[model samples]
Target chain A: MTASSDIDALAAMILARELESALSKRADCGFQLLSSGQEAVAVGVAAALLAHDQLLCSGRSIAPALARGLDPGRVMAELIGRASGPCLGRGGRGHLSQPSAGFFGAHAVVAGNLSIAAGVALALQARRDRSIAVCMFGDGACGAGALHETMNIAALWQLPLLLVCDNNLYSVSTPRAAALAPQRLSDLAAPFGIEACTVDGMDVRVVREAAVELTDYVRNGGGPAFLECISRRYASHSTSARETRGQQELAADRELDPITRLENALLSEGALSAQTAQALREQVRAKVAAACAFADLSPLPVPEEAFADVV
Target chain B: MSSEPVRTRRVFFREAICRAVGETLDAEPNAIVMGQDVGAFGGSYKEFYGLFERFGPARVRDTPVAEAAMVGLGVGAAAAGLRTLVSITYMDFVLLALDPLVNYAAKARFKTGGQIRVPMVVKLTAGAKGQGVAHSQSLESWLMSVPGLRVVAPSNVADAYGLMRSALQADGPVVYVDHKRLFPTSGPLNASAHEVPFGLAAVSRPGRHATIVTHSYMVCVALAACDELAVSGIDCEVIDLRSLAPLDLATVCTSVSKTGALLTLEEGQVVCGIGAEIAYQAQARLGPVRVSRLGAMPAPVSSNPVLEAASLPDAGRVADAVRRLLMEG
Candidate 1:
């Protein structure tokens, strides 16, 4: 149980925030779904995963990919459609993947990766390797039939899968209450006899604790488990989508920002000094700049690349 | 020294499929089968008979009635290092699973830049046998248009065995479509293992007047029409298009060049159908050959015997279409 320290969590959050800021300034970043306010959930779940375990997520993958230990330069290159990326710029924005790094990849569809994660778990179980598959999706995916179907099958077959829902409470303008009838998103797993829990997503420690517990149960052949992290999204649904919330509401949401809260908590406890936090910010900014520089130097894929690897 | 004569045995279409899958399970340690009623029930068409008993529960799995999850599980497993075959009892039910099939399995290799390959087969049973509108459909044309999919249909027992073997060995996603009408029929199959490569059309019958191009059960219909037309001093050539995606236009052009007339027959619709593509491409290659197409009426197929017959093309309709094509040319 080598858990990530509080300082490490703060560094990961700062890196995600810096990456999101850098990506926003680029004109060629295309349609990105930034995980600006939801970094805690991504870092928390990634902290509990082993080297052999696989992690899958929805289109909002910048934070998750970075937290899962992928090379920052290659992830930047992939998002900007460069030939040097893991996917060679073929799976540009909504589909960035590098399975060798244990990040199985990101699929743009809402509930699309749920069953896929179960299948990966099935393969892992077959090998008897004790490695689990984790899928991170949004609140919008909870209403889909794919989730229910995957849950039923995963429970029936005892697949080692961890279903994490990063519930930001909005699906491009539709509130979670208006879209789903469940009192708690994790309650949906109850019907399938899956052990489930809800936690404060804005608190990195809380999210990490829940994730480690659930993943432990799954890795021990306890079948699939569900963990719902109630978080907030600071950005719009995507780069092309419009912001539907009011200014006051946005300000209130920002007050609960995971990065600021973690930094403030660490500062109050004297675990991190003001000068040290400022220096850490400068370090992350430099790292992000280096990643951007590497991506800029890489060339775009050739037009003929569209015909390659297509059976 | 002369080699011993090659031994062959006659087997039903269902038995041919069972042998191919059973052999694959025996050879490949990672291959598994998943679908509804595929375990103890031995598949709805009995095409998977003896597979569950032979492979047991771990390899031969019976899934709940969830098509989306079934396909997603297969695609995910394949991408993660397991080869899988998902059986959709009826082709119509495949619509529920297309999101995973078309979006995930089809584009996996290309999207991952060859980092991952999904060597999975989605076996679908097509055609009408009084099953009504939703259960009866020949949707091969819809799958053919997808960029990274390999669509194969087998009309006889040997092809059923050979094509399945090839599909199991393919590097990416392959849609294996079998017809309801072909299961009862039996044909000779070679004793040794064999594979029918994709993108090749077989010339079933040779003639000089006109050429009939079809696949699956429609090949039988086209052959019967050829027999009837021969009595009236008409000789028709029939070509079976085994693989629809990488269509073998060379074989079709060769047959059309000699006959100078062509009629495309299919059990599916004509608008944006297999015949339309075949006829257009054949004419483009050979330059100005007579062309006609015969297919099901543009209406929903019903369970009623008369309605089902009226909605689909029969031997008489194919014979008339061939006659009209030759007379007009």
Candidate 2:
């Protein structure tokens, strides 16, 4: 593995961990959403894309924002509903977007943003730009009719779009087995003749490798591609949920935590020493602390600006 | 009509709309047209029959039979800097795509604090034409209720051409509704480039006794009713509200104040429709004085033409509505 890839993976884990922890504390701030075990998938997708390429994400995927290099302080501010945030506090935590960073907001609606990403790709194709459009959605979004419609058009038009399905098993409280049929979500692409693959989402290196390969294929004139990452959620679906799934399931998923998996792999491969990993974790914790301070100092949006932007 | 060069050779309403779309696509490179059969097979109404042959598939795209995804794609494309025109084919089918149209496209700019703009036009065909319960309904009022959506309906051929250009040029999203019944109706087409701005009502006919407010195909019925009322000395002033969202209430108020009476005609349902809003606003502005509304009955329009006609307001029904309003005094 390249030195840059190792550092990027470590940094991504730290940022996701910090955001999850901080957001966990603010339980009273409406609903609590987290992308805990799906960090590797989001980070991998983000790392695969070029800087100019755009990312359309779902509300649960904050790792994409951090991986795209958005300011952690600004991310926190947006989450806490601060005026200094990317959306001026109008989007709150779920609908955060930084256009300059190529992170085009996290849509609260499932599969809705996925279709929009296809449009973004169409726009890029219209302009003859080499840049591609990447969209990240959960396993539940895979069953939507909108996704099927989008896949048809994306393949028929040969659009430059990469669809990443973060299959972390449950969508709110429903299990994938009960909701989706035919088991493999990647089969959704087969009817459209688009190339697809499934990867172990807990393995950051493997996810990144798949993302990079698929993104390259899409960036070229190879049309749209799909990458399904088999992930697991260590935490509950939301921050407020008291039930922590089944004990056996939780314990099994916890053992496959992407962050721990990456750290162990790095240490064993001599890519990162145990001491260095410890230092990196401490450094990220302190940085997140500073971001929390910045978020605290951020102001609320003035009431008078409420009616602005209606047009 | 008159020997005017500005009016194109008495072409049908569909031809006028096609001309306008062709002209806009010719002028703007970033503008794209997409719908279910907009490409390859042309449009459902033949509004874009020859566009694909002229502009190729790059600009004219044929999407899957997915209304929600189609609208979502338009919203995304518009925000990404391309002016998009997405067609819903039938207005009744817009129900399947309401989530994206009402939630995503309408709230995108506002929720993003104006950092993004969605300059898109959704071309929908409405009004009853024996297409059946699921296909034949007028839902312009539903779109009118949306905050960020601009709802415009053109009753005549000239307005159709002019309003489409204005919709494409507007800074925000526009829901341009066209009546399916008006597809074959031919009228004097103005060849000159013109634009009908939003929030302005067109006085299709002038009178002094009562003000008849309506839009879309109902404008024709309202005009016919005006002629009948003229014989009875009611002299109804027919005002066609071109844009519903940026409603031209000032014009309606001016006419209401002059006429001292108001009557609203619409093809949509009588309950909570555009006519109801006009009556409410008229009462609010000028204190209710013989105000009455005529619209389709509160039921699904049937596949049978006779049943559809009975449900919808016609010239005779509009005239009767006006007569009832006058008789109340």
Summing lDDT over every window of 10 consecutive residues in candidate 2 chain A, give the lowest-scoring window: A23-32
Question: What does the lDDT read for residue A224 in candidate 2?
Answer: 98
Q: For residues A76-178, what per-residue lDDT tens digits would candidate 2 score against the true structure?
A: 8888888877888788666878866888778888887988888888888777778889999999898899889889889988989999999988888888898
Q: Which digits, one per residue and each the tens of the lDDT, describe model 1 over residues A173-217?
A: 999999999999999999999999999999998899999999999
- The candidate maximizing lDDT is 1
Q: What 10-residue stretch in candidate 1 chain B is worst by lDDT? A: B1-10
What is each candidate's fraction of native interface contacts (fnat)? 0.74, 0.58
Compared with the true structure, the alpha-carbon lDDT of candidate 1 equals 0.93
Per-residue lDDT of model 2, residues B116-157, tens digit only: 789999999998888889888888888898888899999988
RMSD of 2: 1.9
lDDT of 1 by residue, B54-155 (tens): 989989999999999999999999999999999999999999999999999999899988988999999999999999999999999999999999999999
- Measured by DockQ, the strongest candidate is 1
